[model samples]
Each structure stands twice: as structure tokens, then as C-alpha cells.
Target: SDRKFKEILSKSIHDGHKIYEWLDTDEKLKLTRQLAHSVKLIYYLKLQQQLWQDYYDLGIKDGVWAPRISK
Candidate 1:
């Protein structure tokens, strides 16, 4: 829904490569590590959401003492 995302993607692919021409090797490594960390964080967040979804779907704890879950 946001055009900013498209612009950022386009700019990164088309014009972002220019930065590497003068960037230091250490800086590049750091940037790549940051990207990898970001990906791993997103993966864990998705897994956490899925785990909650699985718990809700199972409904095995629907006893009188169990907390009620609303739609």
C-alpha cells in the first residue's frame, strides 16, 4: 500500500550499488551482518506467532480452569 517501499526497492537495486564503489570492506561486512541479524529476528517473530496460532487452534486447554479466548 505504501509507494515508499517500491521506491526504496527500486533505488536499492538501481542506484544503491554506487555506494559499494567507495565503501570500506569492514563497513560492508558490518552491513551484511546487520542484514543477516534482521532476517533472523524476523524468522523468530514469525515462529512465535505460529506457535501461538497452533496453541489456539488445538484448544486442548478448554477446561473449566482454563482461560477463555475470544474471537
Candidate 2:
């Protein structure tokens, strides 16, 4: 499943508007959710890092941003 998901992402990235041609409705929904989660994670991390750096530049010593994942 992981390999297949990777292939879908790769092809979609290169082919641009071809995801509908490659996946059915259910598959499209699943892939969209996965992609959205990934994008949110990346945005959160980047924003956290920027905020931490801002605090550090302002001379705040305890501005450490540590990420912990819990299932």
C-alpha cells in the first residue's frame, strides 16, 4: 500500500491534472486526506520553527520547539 501510494503521489506530481484519471472516487478521497495531513504537518513545523527563531532573536532562552508525536 505504501509503495502504491508513493507511485500515485509521484505520478500526480509530474502529470499535474491526471489524478482523476488514475484513482477512483474513494481512492481520491483517501489520497486527498493523506496529502492534506502531510501539508498541515509541514506548515505547522515551519511556523513553529519560525516562531522559535523569533523568540531566540529577541533573547528568550527557553524558546525551544520540540515536536512529539502521539498516536
Candidate 3:
């Protein structure tokens, strides 16, 4: 999955238009959701990493951002 994700992202960066030929409608729908979820996850992960670094720099031990869970 990681390999596939990297391939898609690399293709988009290098040859954005060519992805149309590689993906069908259904595949596009599924892949869009997959990519969106992955991107959001990576974004928050990076944000968290930066936050941790900032906290470390400030000598703040317990500062963190926690997402809320819903039932």
C-alpha cells in the first residue's frame, strides 16, 4: 500500500495528467478516499511532530494536541 501510495504521489508530481489513464472511475473513487485519508493522517502526524519539537524547544513536557473521539 505504501509503495502504491508513493507511486501515485510520484506520478502526480512528475506527470500529473497521466494518472487519468491509470485509474478508472471506481478506482478513482476508492483511491481518492484512500489518498485523502492518508494525506490527512500524514498532515496531522507532521503537525504533531512539529508540535513535539516546539514543546521540546520550549522545555514544556506535557503540551500536546489530542483529537477527540466520538461514539
Residues 1-71 of candidate 3 have per-residue lDDT tens digits of: 64476466556666756655545466675777687799999999999999987877666445454445699
Candidate 1: the clashing residue pairs are: none
lDDT of 3: 0.68
How many angstroms is residue 69 displaced in model 2 relative to the true structure, after the best TM-score fit?
Answer: 32
Q: Residue pairs in steric clash, candidate 3?
A: none
Candidate 1 lDDT over 36-71, as tens digits, reads 579889999999999987787666555424557799
| Candidate 2 or 1, higher lDDT | 2
Please report how far candidate 2 places residue 15 from its true position, in Å: 18
Q: Give the lowest summed-lDDT range of ten residues in model 1.
A: 1-10
Candidate 2 minimal-lDDT segment of 10 residues: 59-68
Give the per-residue lDDT digits (tens) of candidate 2, residues 15-67: 74565555656767587768768998999999999997787666544545444
Ranking by TM-score: 1, 2, 3
TM-score of 1: 0.51
TM-score of each: 0.51, 0.50, 0.48
The 0-to-1 C-alpha lDDT of every candidate, in the order given, reads: 0.62, 0.68, 0.68
Deviation from truth (RMSD, Å), model 2: 10.3
lDDT of 2: 0.68
